[model samples]
Target: MSVSEREKSYEWQVEDARAGQRVDKFVTAQGEWSRSLVQSWIAEKRVTVNARAVKANYRLQRGDRVALRVPPPEHLAVTPEEIPLDIVYEDADIVVVNKPRGMVVHPAPGHHTGTLVHALLAHCGNLSTINGVYRPGIVHRIDKDTSGLLVAAKNDSAHASLASQLSAHTVERSYTAIVHGDMGHERGTVDAPIGRNPNQRQEMAVVRKNGKRAVTHFVVREKFKGYTLVDCRLETGRTHQIRVHMAFIGHPLVGDPKYGPKKNRFSIQGQALHARTLGFTHPRTGEEMTFEAPLPQDMVDILNRLRRESGL
Candidate 1:
């Protein structure tokens, strides 16, 4: 990575500010950076009011020019280690990958190395830079323990189109999961809205307000003695929506540490969720495309073992 790419700057002018407004809030509203980022810059003395360093709580007057510098996130140089990748499909516009379990989708916090992003960087140089330094070509994300099909955009135009499709709920995504209990019904829909849990910030929950609309449709595929295999489709994407909704209905996914029962029915470290299919239209060509990935051997073995144990 070049040193030049590690820093970015922009100028802003505070206008018509009411008295008693803090400098950080005034500058943040006038600039592209978020308020939290602005506060950090003020503390670091990277934000200057009329070429003078000021505290975040400094009062703002009219026509104050604020200069701010935001450093690029600390990123580990991506090395193309020869990690095996299951390339389901690839084209000029996009690439489909069968991401395996235990692989983080992109670099973050403790997982700065050995991520899919690093591998993609090595495999395809100069991927779409729309997602910034951490995620070069990523369009969507699957949790680290959740294995399944994922798409990557190779260029900016492709990224823009795919992102639009996702936002508009045009992209089709499907998953297969093993949940804790048998769903008596053949099929059902969960239309509960989801948001961050008020009590537990780390988890998501069904909330009435301060939540986004989320709908999940599920069909019972196979029923074991105490568990059910379900095919799930998403109508809206919210963080941890499927996991939270299923658990709310008393059928947490097997092996799901966060949402499942205290005693996990399966031996896997993460949730028993697999992104089985993905479909989208090519941004440039406008042709529809779809891809499917069979369940990983671990999930298959676990199901088979449960069946045999139940004498089914």
Candidate 2:
């Protein structure tokens, strides 16, 4: 089949560690695609090794390049919902939205509706198809419980530009979080590798083997008797990077159900993390732009309660 305009394309350079893995397995491990879906793509000649069509069981070489194209799902449909969006900025090329806590970024098995994508689809009507139908113009994502600012592209060129900037580590993303313990130091950096937890398949952890490089620079903003407010800037965006790193250092974020203590005192719905500031070069204008969102009311209330208890 001819490549569709809505098909998403991806390319990866096989590293030494993944030299002997089957192409289908490798591709499935990289992203949201399942092994069965990858095999279907391989069978359809949508997957290539070094620009040559490859089989599902092809063993990858260390220096080989693997490319895959995924067409929009014909069986699955993403319906546009009239959910309201907290748009911060908008132009012909892009739109910046401050996604509220408890909103999923894209459509998945259980989150088919009531997602940021659904709201964006209803609001924008026309979004870049670089990420296929489920993700539409989504360039990056923050956790569902972590309310923050994220930008969506209106066209392919803008999507490519923003994605390239993220890969180059030039886009600025800063977060504010409330962690469990008072930090010992005023400032520090967590330069560790992050990958899926071997013990818990559903969770992420700091792993030494086969893990991608992840770094987070953090500074103490305020301290309470049992908790610390911190400003964390990500040098690399890894899934659950901040939560994993903070927990690894004995300071898991407050209300973090996945990484924190089983019994928590806080009554918050989820982790007390928020994407506070986002900066990037305008894809169409080549101008630097930055946007900030104030802490959500729930977080503000928690902080106020802490301050009151400490007589601050």
Model 2, runs deviating above 4 Å: 1-45, 49-76
Which number leads on TM-score? 2
- Residue lDDT tens for model 2, 227-260: 9999999999999999999999999998898998
**What do the candidate models score in CA lDDT, each in turn?**
0.84, 0.90
Candidate 1 per-residue lDDT, tens place, 6-73, comes to 77777877678444688887665553344555687799999898899999989877777778887775
TM-score between model 1 and native: 0.77
**Model 1 clashing residue pairs (backbone):** none
Counting only residues 3 or more apart in sequence or on different chains, how many pairs clash (N, Cα, C under 3 Å) in candidate 1?
Answer: 0
**TM per model?**
0.77, 0.82
Number of backbone collisions per candidate = 0, 0
